[model samples]
Every structure is written in structure tokens, then in C-alpha cells.
Target: MNHDTDAMFRTLKPAGLDTTVAEAHARRREQDLAAAWDATGSGRGVSAPAARRRMPRVLVAGLAAGAVAASAAFVIAATDGSGNSPGARPTASGTVRALDARAILLASADSAAKAPLTTGAYWYTRERETHFVAPMKLTEAQQKEVDRKLGTRLKGKTKADKSSPVTAWVSHTQESWSGRDRHARTIVGIDPKIKFASPADEAKWRTLSESQRARLQLDVPAEPHVNNYDFSHAKLLKTDEEKQVSALAKLPSDPAGLEKTLRKWYQDERALEMSLDGRTSENSFAAYVFGEAQDLLAGPLTPGAKAALYRVLAEQPGIRYLGTATDSMGRKGAVLALGTNGDDTGPIGKNFEIRLIVDPRSGRLLAQESGDRKAPSLTMTYEAMGWVNSLGARP
Candidate 1:
């Protein structure tokens, strides 16, 4: 859309500027977004003058909608204060002042988190994952669930002093019953790079953070309520540096039936794309895939890891199994063909594309790509979205 997709994505963050005002603004924004979305159909959109024939009505409408929702247009034109909202000011990154997810959550506990649930407490779902990293040790109640997720002690660890790279105990619970029908999902994490002066200096933050803090309550809003929250604020890291992959590597290298896991991720990413496609956006098939996608993405690769990778690549959407092959990187990776002509994928007919190249030696998405926007496809380089300093070459 004419509205920079990146900017639109930013507006969807856990907002707290105004509760009542935010909701009203949010509803109108959703409508504008939907209308803007309608204009992007491969076809079936409004006609444009010769000068703008290539652009869809959706793009134009989305720009207008975004301006209304943000309450002000973020013109690409020069600005003095970077891009942060007025009065909110901007950090070096153009976001609010520094403080990683870890510190922010701890400080926000007394303010944002409600009683019984406790402040600094949050429920997270990463494709069925219940584990999270924290900056501090876990509280007794929080440790129970963390232990449940870890499935065992940290190999000779004590309750008082456990050796976790990121030390913190967080909770994950399912609220089976609620007074209201709507569901509530909150995920709050920390990012050490945020750099707080010290506990005392940081302690005063809960008040300074009145605008950005998230409340641990049921039924906030998002067209699709993502139960996932990146408490780590690690989006800045490149794929090669993501903290979890190596941790997965530490697990038993000899994995059996790894196909199930691989296929799960393929299904998850594929289904998610389709659901996001807006055609079958409401189907269980898509939802089911998303529900399991994250579990499939992460791991302590068991004896079943490699096989799972092969199997999933064997069935990934827009992928054609080209049989076993090696990549230019010389990693013993498999090659998968992307695009509608894929024998296994049939025709998505959408303009999207995908490429999954893995290191067969270690079942990992060494490099991948996907998306309708060709310059920097969604494939594997999430570093796109222009968030990073560079957008690596696409295969």
C-alpha cells in the first residue's frame, strides 16, 4: 500500500496511549485498513488514471487510513525529531527511550500487570512453546511453569541459583474460565541491550512508562490476537545470530523422524501466509497450521530432527523437492523450488515466492526467502522490513 507497510506494522504494536480513545481510534483504523486491504487483490480493484495504473486503490486508501489512525501523517518528508510520535519523543532507534523487554517488564509489574496474575507476569505462546528467557531469577510461582516447559532441571541446577544464559522465571498459564467471553493474551519480555542506568534509576520507570505499558488483562485488540510477545526485543539480530538455534544444536544431534517437526514449520509458515492472504483468512486449516508452526520452528533437536527437516521440506508450500543437493555455501543442504508451478505446492497463483535452503548437516533454515514484493522477498530474510542495516542478497 502507499502507506509504508513497515509503518503500518509498527502501528499494530501493543499500544497504551489511550484506552477509550485508543479503542475508538483503533476501530476506525481497522475499517480503513480493511478497505485499504481490499484494494490489493491481484485484480478486482478500482481503475486508475494512466499515471497511476500500476498502483492499486488499496495502496492509496491504506495511506489515508494510516494517517487517520496514527492521528498524524508520518510524511517521508524531512523531520527534525526522527519518527517518534510527538510529546513521546524518540530514542536513537527512533522508538521510546532505551530499556529492554526484561527490565521494562519487571519495572512495569506493579503498574501494568493486575492483581492475582501479579505484575511482571505474562503468558506467552510461541507455536506451543512455553519457555522464555528472563533477566532475573524466577519467582516460585513462575518457576513451576518454567520447569514444566524445560521438562527437567538444568542438569544439576539448584532452585536458588540456576545457570540460565538469561536468568528469569516467567509464567505461562491457561485461564480456562473468564468472566468475559473475550480472550486475553499478554507477552512481555526484556532486552538487555536496552541499557538501564541501574535498578534505582530504572525503578522510577514504571511511571515514565505509563504510555507504553501493557496490562495483563483479557481481551485487548488485534484483528488477529497474537499470543506471542518478544520479551527479548531481539528482532535486531540477524538470522545467523538468533539465540535459540545453537541451543537447539546443543541437543542430541541424532534426531529421528525429524520430518514431523520440519513439516510442522512448513505447514505453519505456509498456512500463515495463506491466512494472511485474506482469501481463506478465517479457516481452521490455516489456524491449525499457525497454532503448531512455532513449535515446529524451535527445538532441542531430538534424535528425530534431521528426518523432520527433510520431510517438512518434502511437503512445504510453493516448494518443489529438487532432491538432495548442496548450496553455494557448501552446507549439505537440500534444494526446494518455490512458486506456483511447484509439483507439490500446486498453484497459489499469488505473486509470492519462496526458497528454503538448509544445512543438511544441521537442519536449519540457513537461508530462505518468500513474499510478493520481489526486491526483498519474505522468504527467509526477515531482516528485511528495512529494520536492519542490510538486506542480504536473495537467492
Candidate 2:
């Protein structure tokens, strides 16, 4: 396998979780792995569309713990392109010239606390996702194996045929609307305009067979279909969405109370994990809370609760400021990262970073990125989020 593909599998497994819970998280990881494989034109000939099906929310619950653990190998990069350290404090002019990760989180908490609340019939959100697929570098034998699987015979006679690897950028957009009645609708639009590294690579791609191209996941339908879900039966609805919405209504506003409540929830979740697999996790409590907060930040949160979550993040260790950067949607925001690169005797022995870009003015989460610092393997940008009166509306 190529380095990119190998790196993906190495980083996919979550540390400190047993096979049972890890398998649940694997559903999502499989999609990502398949995408990378398809982009590289290696591995089993599974179409990206087939592997890109969205997993159920039941499987999505408690994913933050694993995600945070997967990023434990992240090495800190330079802070803000400035020679300053991550502990730098903002100047007294009220302008954030250079601020530490803790200070940034604190400022975001203050902004979140004062944010205005809104209400509507449905909660609407629009997000863009980009997955970078590195070029596949295969040996002659590996290329032959790929050809045999696809029933193709394109010999490397020309220089173009012998090109080292072809790089691809895969991107898509997803929109969702969830009502107070527990009904939800989701739409996923795959971007047809995939960017290639060079015209030579594009030319090489056209020479492949139709089936071979399909395995590349480039033939996705431009018009996305809508998926609907009904969860009106409160007693029967035991999904994570139900739990999240229910919890949002009752979360304590104060930071102390919120932290206390979250800890109780964490203990309950850990207990459930122990009951199911009989394995206890060695992950830090702060890391677990940080992961949970990361997931909750995307949902409809009360201003006070959101503020408390930010404050909770401020207390966690290993967080560093990455300065300002533009998200996939071309919006500028302050980037904060949490991770460390060191010898970890965990299930997954690979290292990667997780970054969260926040709008300092509104304390809104703009985007999230994960993977190596040079090129993120996965990036999710929040284009729009708020309450809407109708299912087809945007906020």
C-alpha cells in the first residue's frame, strides 16, 4: 500500500477503546478509508458512492472520545507564523495581536455568553466537506495487480502512463433540517468539479475504462437526493439526536454546573462502555469532555451552555493557537488546536492533528480539520447554521 493509504489506516483506529465501540466508529472511518482508496485508484474496486453512505446517529454517538484519542500524536506547529510562543498574551489595545490558546477560548466564551438566542420550527445547517487524496505511488507489480482487478491492460509504455501519482481533491456539500417534532431531512450534494493536480493527470484519468473511473468515485450524481427521518415517538426514539436535543434543553448555564453535569454524563457513558465490552478506557477525563464539546458545538446550543463549553476547553492541556486561517468556505477565523506528539502506547500508534477554526466575534465554529499539518486529510466547513421556519429554507 502507498504511504497515504497506510497512514490513513494507521490513524483510523481510536486509542483506548475496545473493538466493540471502535467498530461502531469504524463505520465512519471506513467511508473515509474507501474515499482515500478510490482517490488513489488502489485497494478493492469499491465505488466511493457505495462507501459514502451516511451512518446512523446511534453509531455516531461517543465518537468524540475516539477522535480526540486519534489526534494524540499531533505535534505542535509554530504559533501564528509569528516567532512568538503559544503562551503569548494579547496586547492591551483590545486587539488580538497574539493570544494563547487558553486566552482565545476565554474570549470565545465571553462572545458566546452574549450571543442572541433564536427559535423556529426547524434547525437548519449547511456544511462543506473536503477530503484530500494524495497521489498513489505504486510499484510495477502493484500497478499490474490494480489492472488485473479492473480487467484493464494499459501498459506503461509512454511517459504519461508511467507518471508517479495523480493527486485529487474530493469535495461535497451537506444540508440538513431538523424539526422540534424530531423529524429530520438531509441533502448531500457531491461536487462534480474535482480538481486535479495537472492536465497530464486529467488526461491519464480519461484513458481509464468506465468501470475503472466509477471506482474513482468521480461519477456521482450532481443533484443530491433528500433523506428523511421520523423520530416523533419519544419513548421509542433512543437515538443520539434525541439525546442531544433533550440534553440541550436542560444543560446548566453556569460553567461549574455545566462541567459537573458533563462529568456525570461521561461517567455514565464510560460505565455503559464497560458493561458492553468489559474494557475500561485510559483516556483522560478532560480529553473526553473536549471531544463531547466538539460534537455539541455543531448542534443548537444555548448561549450560556455554549459559553460554558468554551470555558471547559480552556482548562484542557496541550491546546495551542494556530493563528488566523481561512476555512474551505473562504471565511477567516481564529484556529485553535489540541494535541501532542510523543511516545503513546495506544491501540493506534500514529500521530495527527485536529484543528478547530472559530469566529472570534460570534464565537461560532467555522470549520474543523484533521490530519497532517501540510495537507489535511479531512476538512468540514460550516457554511450556514440557524433556525428556519421551513424545511427547504436556509438561515
Candidate 3:
């Protein structure tokens, strides 16, 4: 196995509750990870569509995840690190096919690489410096705030998600205590309005049956709002155009390009500077995105300008197509809608539109607009979209 893979396997784990939960909350603050769960065109798509209009009432199913920090049996990576198994490949496609029940647990072994963590190599790295990670004491007052923000109840969630009142522990490297003691305890719960029509609706939910409330609040609403449409499924509905599952069975064996943009768009030093203040709320969110986007989305592109597209889109999860359009740079671009990867998938109120401009001829990005994915998914409407001829049409 490659040295990186060996090191990755040796260092990774699901992480303690404080680490996992913090990682979740931190992802929310980054522009890219914030969009992952939405139906818009992922980093691979060409256009930005408008967010669908949604009804005032919407169903919001909550999600949470957790991991117990264990030594011994849990420290190993993969079902067995036997030679070049399928799980070793980092391709964005079907690496999961190799996993059976045993591999599933091993699959999560590296889940620790994601952000909202503040240890090891996590504190300072490239464009990800926009994210911050520096271990600090979890105070009593701070724990409550974390619970309030997690906004996704963990009762049915994962172990870290379920660990309540937030107990935090740290093993202080493999040399530290080597037993079942927790390094940290973390609890997560849904925001008050996450399900109800509004805060007032929350009151009504308390009076409603648990199943009734769960069912009513979990149905993704369908309104005229642009955010309501799932661009991933749009072609299937026939209401929109068709976009086939990627013809490339697996994202290129060794995709490239993302590192360039992050290096260019957000200077590494500045991003790192942000990390220097790791205790701030913004640092947590930034760190989450840095870690998640680094491995989860990066390194799967074909190359050149397309690589840049993959980088931006990989980070912006809820982005979708808004059809063809010209950009401020006057390069014709395919507009894509944007949304927050937030639990609410229905109509997102306010600004939530993200746009990307591509050179129609070279397929290079000319300009970009990353907006909220709620209402106004695009700053430019579908009709307003067109190709920009840097060369004159008359000529």
C-alpha cells in the first residue's frame, strides 16, 4: 500500500462525540459542505437552476452521527488490510461495493478525517484555513450552545449523536489511557422550528402525536419555490431536461485540479490565518468544510478547467442548474441553483442562489456567484442565460 494510505489508515477513526458533533456543526458554516445534501447539480453539473418556491409549512427530518473513541479492536482500518482490496480506492464512484457488514465498520474508520475537529494535521492546511481547529476545553455554558445549534436530535442518531449532556474526553495520543473512557460527550437536538410551521407550530407539535408530528414535519414540501426541485432527479420527472448518471463508471482513476483553485481563489495563508483564531464559532464551521471537502469531494475530476468546476461544485452541495446564461465576465455560462445543505429541503426563504459561468467553447469557468440556496437560486433567470462570444458574432 502507498505510504499515504498506510498513514491514513493508521491515524483515522470515528472520533469522540465532541469531535463528531463539532464536525457536523462546523460543516454548516462552510459555503460548500452547507450544500452537499441538496438536489442541485453537484460540482459536476453545468448550470444553475432557480430554487423551487416552497409552502410555508415543511417537513424536516433530522440526522445525526456519532462514534465512540475506542482502542484495541476499533483502531484497525478495513475488514482486513489484506493487499489491494476494493475499499482502498478513493474514487468517487463505487468503492462502497466492496464492503460487506465487516467492511462497513471499517469504512467508518477513516471518517475521522472530516473536519469540526481540532487535532493532529487538522489545524493548519491550505485553502481550508478558512476553517479552524484547535482543541479547547468544552465548558458547561459552551455545551448548551452546541446542543442548541446542532438542531438535529440524536436520540435515533449515532452514538456520538446520542451521547447527551455532552461528555468530552481525549486519550492524548495512543500513549494515553487505553480503555473505554470517553474523551468527550456530545449531545445534538433539532432546532425549535426545524419541524413545526413556525415557533407557534412547535407549540402545536407538542400537543400532536409523536408519529403525527414526525410524519407531518418530515415530508419534503413541493411548492413553486426553486429549492424544492431536486435537480439530481429532475431528468427522471420529465418536467426538466435529462442528465444521465455519469458515463464514467468511476470518477477518473486519478482525478485532478481542485487543489489549484483553492490555492488560487482563497489564498492558503489567509485561510490559515482564519484557523489561528480557532475558538471562534466561524472557525468550527470552516474547519468542518475544509476536512469534508478535501477528501469527500476533491481529487475526482478529469483535469484542466473541468477540475476547477469539480472543486467548486464539490464544495457547494445544493447547487443546481438554472439553464444557459451569460456571466458578468460576459462568458456564456450554464446557471445552477444553490441551496444550503441544511435539514430543511423545502423552499428556503431569503437568498440561496449560486451561479457558475463557463466558457461555452473551452468549458472553462469565467465567473461564479455563490448565493444562498433558498429563494432566488440564481441571480440571473433562465431566459437571461446565453453564451458570450469573446469573438464578435459579425466577424
Candidate 4:
């Protein structure tokens, strides 16, 4: 990536934005990513034309924005060239026949519909998030600027060693406890660790002060930050707090009815956006519905409603089954890919793919991953989720 793009990525602070503003920022970021990828080739056999293919506008928009809006798409592909439909099932002869995406999702929906409903004082969730940073060389001017900003000079390397870049991964644990009465608390433990590609990289990293490292988005305080939110007064989601909580049980329980209700909501939202901005993209309806479904899944919902969401997902286009895989937490589940031609390349760039791992038996989402198939750039794993009696309690 270019220096400007890298700097923009490092400086993004979306914590303060409302839902609408955050979505706008997310769109701009996607455009920036596409532009950056175009300027600098991915060198992964993905041609410019293929990489620039107009994927569904809102593919994974909800996941990218870290908000409760529209989410990504999932494609369907046949595993054994059988061209099975959504109701297809595995063979009974003990021979392993890979099931299609629709079948997997439909089965999950059935399981979800049977789940027992429970209530508690708070809806709690624990998640682990990881972000991978690739190595990139910096220009001499960039290096000097960083050094000056940090008030330190490199130990050696007058000019020749600027070609080296560092490789590292940053990760953190996030927990949330939300109550139906519009009260919520979120805690984020920012733990960033760096692994140098070489001794030179390590030396360069070691020269920076702790504050400087934090400024560069390389380090953060060891302590966890807690934030309290009063949803009644906050503009968080598209709907108000009362509706958001009430819809958990009030949403349609049948697939067709649920889809219809969600479509109406999408149309109303778009109409409002068009009236305000004079124009709104019409390609994001599917993404918006999926995003809403995802958001509802994170909260307490009736089993029928949850199952309806899975059925709705099964009905989408371009969903492909990637077989089964283990999540970041080492839990095995069925995997699905979206917005791709059954390859690593997609609208984002070469070696990048949007994937979701779902637990079919329990009809729960295990993880969402984006980037390289071997090593994704971002991975969000659901460690635990359920109703708890108190804020700090786990499932």
C-alpha cells in the first residue's frame, strides 16, 4: 500500500460515529482499498479486470463497518457436481458427500428453530479480533518523518536499509453486555504484539517510545477500556432502542414473511437516504437485509426468527460451500464463501476472500474472516454468547 493509504488506515477512529456516519466512512474506505489495490498490484495472478469486477456493492459492508447494518453475501456451489438444491441431504451409505451451501444453511435453520429460548438480565458476548499487517517498505521521507515524530533516530542504516519492512499481527479481546432496558457496557482489551521479519525490523521497532508506538497504531495501554451506553438516548442502529429490543421477538418467524418485512425496512431506509442525499445505491438491499439478520443473531431472539434468518441466507445468490474448517477458537464448523468466483480473488483484491464459518448443529455463527484464505487480514471469532445474570458473567 502507499504511504497515504497506510496512514489513513492507521488513523481511522470510528468509535464516535453514529450508524449513518459509520456506514458512510465504511463506503469511502472500501473505495480507498480498491484504489490502493489498483495502484499497487497484488501479484497473486488476479488481473486488474478481474479484481475490479463490480461485486455486490454491500458485500460484507456490515462486517467492515463494525455496525449492525447490512452484511456480506454467500454463494452456493456444488461439492460433487450433483447440482443439488437447497433441500439436498448427505448420503446414507456412509460415503462422505459434501453438502451444498443451501443444504447446510437449511439444516442449520431447522436446528435453530428448535433451540430453547432463555432470558436473563443481560445479553452477553465475548469475542476475539485479530488484524494482520503485511510488510511494506517505507520511503526515506516517510522514515525521517516517523523518526522525527518519535524524537529518535535509527541506530544505523544511513539510507540503504530502508527497503526492509516489518511484519506483525495485532489482536484484542472485546466483551459486551446489553440489557433490554437500553443499558449496555462494552470493554475492549487492546493487546498488540509485534513479530519482526528481521533483526533490523526489531531494532527499528525498539527505538520508538511507547507513546510513539501507540501513535503509529503499533501499541496500546495494557489496561482495558470500559464504555457505557444508554441506547434510549443514542443513535446506534437504524431503529430506536425500543424497536431494536422489541423486534427480537416481534420479527416474522416464517422465511417468506421475514424476508418481506426486512425488504420493506430496506426500501424505507433507502427512500429516506435518497430524499436526503438525492441519490442512494440500489444494489445494497441484499447486503442490508443480511446485516440486519446478523445483528439480530447477536442479540436474544426467538428460535423461529433465528431460523428464518438462516433460510433467508440460503435463498441468496452466489453462495458457495467451502467445506468445513475450524474457527480461531478451534471449533470446527461448515464454511461458506461469498462475492467470488470460487477463488481467492474477489471484488476486494487478489488473495482476498470473505468467509463465514457457521455451526450447523446449533445454527450459530462461529467466525467471520476476510483476506487471504491461508492467513486472513481480519478474523472475528465468537468465543461465547448467551444470556447472563450480570455484566461480567459468561455463558
Best by lDDT: 2
**How would you encode candidate 1's per-residue C-alpha lDDT over 276-368 as one tens digit per residue?**
442222223322222222233322233244333333333334333332223223333223334423331222223323334332323343333
> How high a TM-score does candidate 1 get?
0.24
What are the TM-scores, per candidate, against the unseen true structure? 0.24, 0.63, 0.22, 0.62
Order of the predicted models by TM-score, top scorer first: 2, 4, 1, 3
Model 3 residue runs over 4 Å out of place are 1-316, 328-331, 340-350, 370-395
List, residue by residue over 1-395, the lDDT tens digit for candidate 2. 69999899768967645777755543433332222222212111101111111211111111211323322221222233333343332333323333556666776787788889877778777777654443334446545544443345777455333332345445677788877777888887645456665687678667766665554443345588789888787454223533445456557778899888777776776686576546545446665665465456776778888998888888877777765655554555567765322222222213344567776567888777554444444556777888888878988
lDDT of each: 0.27, 0.55, 0.26, 0.55
For model 4, residues 300-345, the per-residue Cα lDDT tens digits are: 7778988998889888775667655555555556666663333334
Deviation of model 1 at 115, angstroms? 45
lDDT for position 371 in model 4:
46
Residues 1-395, candidate 3: write the lDDT tens digits.
69989789657854486688766543322212112111122222221111121101111111110111121110101111223332232223323222221222111222212212111201110110000011123344433434434433333444322222121111110001100111211111111112221364345435545554333322222221111112332233221111112211122322243444333323433344345533223222222233223222211123322333343344433333343434322334333333333221322222322233332223333333332222111121111211112211111
Q: Which ten residues in a row are the worst by lDDT in model 2?
A: 42-51
After superposition, which runs of candidate 4 have C-alpha atoms over 4 Å from their true positions? Answer: 1-98, 134-166, 190-203, 207-217, 235-243, 268-284, 290-294, 340-353, 372-375
Poorly placed runs, candidate 1 (over 4 Å): 1-300, 315-318, 321-333, 339-349, 379-395
Model 4 earns a TM-score of 0.62
In the predicted model 2, the residue pairs found to clash are: none
Query: Global CA lDDT of candidate 4, please?
Result: 0.55
